[model samples]
Target: MFEQAYGRLVCFADGQREIIAMQWKQGATCAVHDHGATASGRVHLVVGALVEERFSFDGQRLCHTTTLHHVAPCTIEVPPGLIHRMTASPDATLTLSIHHYEPCIASMRIYDPEGRRTVIVPDDCGAWIPEDAAAIVAIEPWSAP
Candidate 1:
């Protein structure tokens, strides 16, 4: 389970004209389980590592899992057109100043995969829902959703 959270800054699609700041603490993360809406997404990390776990959804089925670890002061880009699942590091206290330079909307969904059903938590909300991503996918890109 994610015992640590993430800090976020949002940028629009047309250009960098918006600066929306969102932050969370330990044992928290965006539970929407998603990624950007384009082929390229960029972010300037100020602090903290954002732990992202990737997955493949076959419409009615969710396949594979990959856990990506990203530290602060770093820029992460997901290849254009890939459905992604992301989460913040569950390590400890950390912070990140995200400068959304290229206009990317990162989303994530949280659930207890080992539980009874699919628990898809929407974006813009923070919650602690941890499942072993490696148990579902094969590669861990180590970035945010």
Candidate 2:
């Protein structure tokens, strides 16, 4: 188990399949990120609610696509190569969810549209950039649809 700025993570499996239980605080938002190249996953909302912001990457920049609201007792399919960020709903003090990933995510790409930078981080680091990561400025600015 690990404690992150946004919440706590308890990893159940890390072999061919990865299962992680996460507890997020109200209003806590994860960095925009994508699953590893070939990895796909599902998020099972166990408690509270979440808001997901989905994005699409053009050849040059990342563009906002849609926003989804998920309540407890629901599941969200995360397709391969999908880029998104999740925020804990303010209506709940804490949100809990289980994330299942196949072929376990080895690394993730974090996009910082405002900073105009991107960083690749290990799965253990979640969507947030680690202190040791070196961000690379994007050649083109991000956009919203």
Question: For each candidate, what is the lDDT?
Answer: 0.47, 0.77
Q: Mind giving the per-residue lDDT tens digits that candidate 1 earns over 35-132?
A: 33442445455666677666675444445577777777687665554445445456746555443423433333343343423333333333334354
Clash totals in order: 22, 0
**Model 2 segments beyond 4 Å from truth?**
1-5, 134-145
What TM-score against the true fold does each predicted structure earn? 0.52, 0.84
lDDT of 2 by residue, 37-58 (tens): 8888999999999999999877
Estimate the lDDT of model 1: 0.47
For candidate 2, the per-residue lDDT at 93 reads 78
Angstrom error at residue 42, model 2: 0.9
How well does candidate 1 score on lDDT at residue 55? 69
The candidate 1 region of ten consecutive residues with least summed lDDT is 136-145
The regions of model 1 sitting more than 4 angstroms off are: 1-20, 36-39, 97-145
